[model samples]
Target chain A: MAEKKIKIIVAKPGLDGHDRGAKLLSRIFAEAGMEVVYTGLRQTPEMIVEAALQEDADVVGLSSLSGVHNYFFPKVVELLKAKKLANVLVVGGGIIPLEDIPELKKAGIAEIFGPGTSTEVIVDFIRSNVKAK
Target chain B: MFDVKELEKIKAGKKKWSEGTLAKTLSKAPEKKAKTTWSGIPVETLYTPAENAGLDYESKLGYPGEYPYTRGVQPNMFRGRFWTMRQYAGFGSAKETNARYRYLLGQGQTGLSVAFHLPTQAGYDSDHPLSMGEVGKVGAAIDHIGDMRILFDQIPLDKVTTSMTVNAAATALLGMYLSVAEEQGAKYDQLGGTIQNDVLKEIICRGQYIYPPKPTMRLTVDLIEFCQKYVPRWNSISISGYHIRESGSTAAQEMAFTIADGIAYAEACAARGIPVDSFAPRLSFFFNAFTDVLEEVAKFRAARRVWAKIMKDRFKAKDPRSMMLRYHVQTGGVTLTAQQPLNNIVRVALQTFATALGGHQSLHTNSYDEALCLPTQGAVTVALRTQQIIAEESGACVTVDPLAGSYYIEYLTDKIEAEIEDYIKKIDAMGGTLTAIEQGYIQKEIQNSAYLFQKSIDSGERAYVGVNKYTMEEPPVTDLLRVDMKVGEEKAKELKEWRAKRDNAAWKKSLDKLREVSKTDTNVMPTVIEAVKAGATVGEVCDVWRDVFGQYRPKEFIS
Candidate 1:
């Protein structure tokens, strides 16, 4: 049987209006032939988690340009766990600092892409890391 | 420029060169490299006088400061004075940001460009639950008039011009700004500055738009009218292509689409029975300057010429001041890199040179460390020094429109101007910018262009020196400036104190009056000033408007 297309929800979870990175990643996902559910600017954690469940997404990519990634990114992870969606993979990108990476990854985020990571790297990571439903 | 005899001979020579014995010698060399600006305008191997053919020098390329200002907007340009070197600075609490402003001013920064915190920009109080983890993260956090008071406490409002990058809560911020001036005993006419009251593009590119377009446009126009009536020296709206360029547009798209927004604003003001010349002179523009110096110079010249024609021919403005296109430029922020972060200095320097050559009235150079985090103090000084070096040492400011007669630059200017005008005509055919933005036409264009731009970088079609071509494994950037995490807590605590100390009854009455004014045909500025004086916070006033004019929720773009 042919493999099902990977579905992901790209979310921006704060008051930050800079959406260029989020837009770039969502388009990259679409270009890789994945099903992308883009939750545009100012989405909350509850909304992102609900959308992840509603879309039955294989991945949830959080792009935070505001320095709230330390608080907001892990909150999404916790929301997913409470919602009992253990199969979903959490990832992030943007202006997240270097020191915050370890704790975020430890909080069960699959990976984090920084500024210079190519789209091919993201595509390959999603293809290999996310397990389809 | 070229006589018919010389032109024909050159045309014949070009043809012969391409296919003749000269071609045989050139065949040994590699194929010519194709080039274009980031906006994707096609580039030729070389340009000639044939490119500027049939273009009249007197009418098309008038003298600097003349009508249809294709050369420069001012007669003497930089020789009269250097462009205001304003570096955008703000991060942390009001007290901290005040010090940063003073520091920048002491270091030769002639003006202030305030970058409010994310919650502040979104018109939320720092204590709002939604503001957690984000207060003072991007820029300064100013919740109430108290915070605004601290922000400009010592900086005399009359002496220093400020540009507030505000939109959804422009009225509230301007209210606090005016109140600050009142407390300082400064005359309204003495204050010179800009509140970036361009709401149309905020919906199209930046997602910080609060009220839907109609009311947003109302508030935008209200400020323009209010500024004209009271703050005569203030620029009401800096119609911004800077954010549009940051969001991903070809250089021409940035100019064309921004001018389209300008036309919409002018039409809206005219619809309010305000004559074009009354407010058009105070109208200003803000654009982004990128690393491509020649294209950027051409882009600026083209934009000036386009706006001159639009004001004179389209709007029938009588005053020459109304026809001039005065603008400010900021170096590209999106072009900065994380890897080998120091390379950004070179990028910023080159971009600054372009902004100067483009004859900007003002400029802000992005700090090199911005790609990593908020700029440290060290980085901001270097950024300011870049502008000073270009002005003093580079000899770029010695003359006006030095590249005016270059065949290639002239060709690019004329071509870019025509391309942008074509876009304006198309937008006009679609009814206007409002209709186009509503239909997501402009947003879709930006989205598509952004996608292609990233694809180029990914495919290595674009050479981002530190990103793809000259890749190196580097240690993580740890020396970056990070905002203290205690900012949110401290701000919330202080807000509690501010709420207790202020007279609640008067604040409530002012808010009620603000709501009443919003419902009527009254300009909201006077009421807003009263509200701030009555001790209302930015969020409280914005909440009042939100109740009156519902907050906007754009249609979901992807699923």
Candidate 2:
């Protein structure tokens, strides 16, 4: 039986222009036989959510490096919920402090990967946490 | 190099030593790691003069302070004076950043580098919807001359050298800065500072570009022209490879792409009928001093040699200063690890050694807490003190080109230079950097290198200390600095008040004049200065330019 490939939308939100992580992840996801939609730099929360819904992504990784992660990450989650994207798994990374992880996960982020996280862990997390429904 | 007889003797001795000594050691314990560096350049067990046999020392590496400067740019180098310690800083409001600048200056920081918030860098007002959550996060928020004045208030502009980390809106920022200097009663000719006005790299890696390549190149060239005439002491454009490296380019790619961009800028200015010698002297470069100590040292030396040849032989520049490649180095930001946070301090210290040994004219060391948040005052102080300790305690300042005449260093220097030249040749054949970028050649190359680098790290081919090996459990870092969200609202309120109180008639007249200059071959600085002095906001002035020169949409590349 053929299974559906995992589709992920990697978007860099807010005004921070550091896209090394997002671009690398997008490439790695594609190389891992998944569909990756990359929203270029300076994407607003609304734009990110729109892209996620339009791409029919099972996982949306929001990368925010600026210290505004607390404001931007939650807004993305809220917008995702408002759009009835409850089935999509949301992940956050890039300069988010360890203390903020619990609150972010509570706010509907499925996983929060801090720096030095191996790509294998992220890949496995996506494979398991992303709902196949 | 050794004489023929001595070379023969040394070669015979080396062959015997490798067979007996190296074979015995390898038999006991084979090499575990791959024989390559992080950049994928192969490494030899040992380098010797045999590897540097064909190197033309006199032509490739002339005297220190001579053309084709490979050893050092200046005659005495660090023996005469230490490199300027420029700390890159900015966060919160203008008033807050102003205080930080003064504090750094008081602690013996020699230069000021301003990091603008995202909105400012992207040419948006603090109140713009696109800037809602990002007004003053990464850097300070400056809306107009009012904030610019506050940012430099009480600090003597002429006595202190400043560097603004701006690109898209650099024209307005430079205008605001010059107005500040005028208000300080200092002549424009005596101002010492740098504005990172190079937009080509923004289009390539950084996403702060405001206009298409043609108009953006015009703006970059206009600054070069205007600074050559008025702001004689200022570096108009800092040709940047730092961001390219931060985007995961190899050291050779960093050198070649940066030099290629400089070539494009020079060619643009030439097409505008400006003499090369008129502006080339003020042209400075910004580079990344990564953790590869020997590679970095060789890269710096190779850059000077390459740029000198480009100016003298290619551009036919007559001035000696035009051929001299002066540069500022910043330690790599991406190399810092969030795990085992204290391990970063050692990484930074070692990287700082690379910058000092690479003969950087100025340097900025990354703070330890940057991998977590904006560096706090204590972290920034430690960052600055790292440079200071290297200058005072370390034996770095005692000699010039201290690592000269090393077998490995010379060999690597030659190798990196050849590879960089190869890339430059490829770029040149494709009709220079702008054409190459538009065709997605450079970006794809960089993206491929980045992917290879990431794969190597993931596959354990390249080992990061606390990341893949030496694992440990540590708690979250709590002492990191956080910018209060009130900075954005406060700045918006201040901008509203400033606009409401300003003379609307004069502001419009100045902006109208700015709009007029945007459509012609006339210089943009005078009108930009007039508009900024007339209370035009940063966004307002940039909006005028945006109306005339269309905004740039980046080209996408997949590798």
For model 1, residues A1-133, the per-residue Cα lDDT tens digits are 8888999999999897778778877877887899898888888888999999999989999998777888888899899989999789999998877777999999988898888789899889989999655
Per residue, candidate 1 scores C-alpha lDDT tens digits across B33-112 of: 56877677888766777777866788878888899888788999999899999888789999999999998888888999
Interface RMSD of each: 2.0, 1.1
TM-score of each: 0.98, 0.98
The residue pairs in collision within model 1 are none
Instruction: Name the regions of candidate 2 deviating beyond 4 angstroms.
Output: none
Question: TM-score for model 2?
Answer: 0.98
- The docking category that best describes candidate 2 is medium
After superposition on all C-alphas, the RMSD of every candidate to the true structure, in Å, is 1.5, 1.3
Q: Rate the local accuracy (lDDT) of all candidates.
A: 0.88, 0.88
How much of the true A–B contact set does each candidate keep? Answer: 0.62, 0.71
DockQ per candidate, 2 decimals: 0.65, 0.77
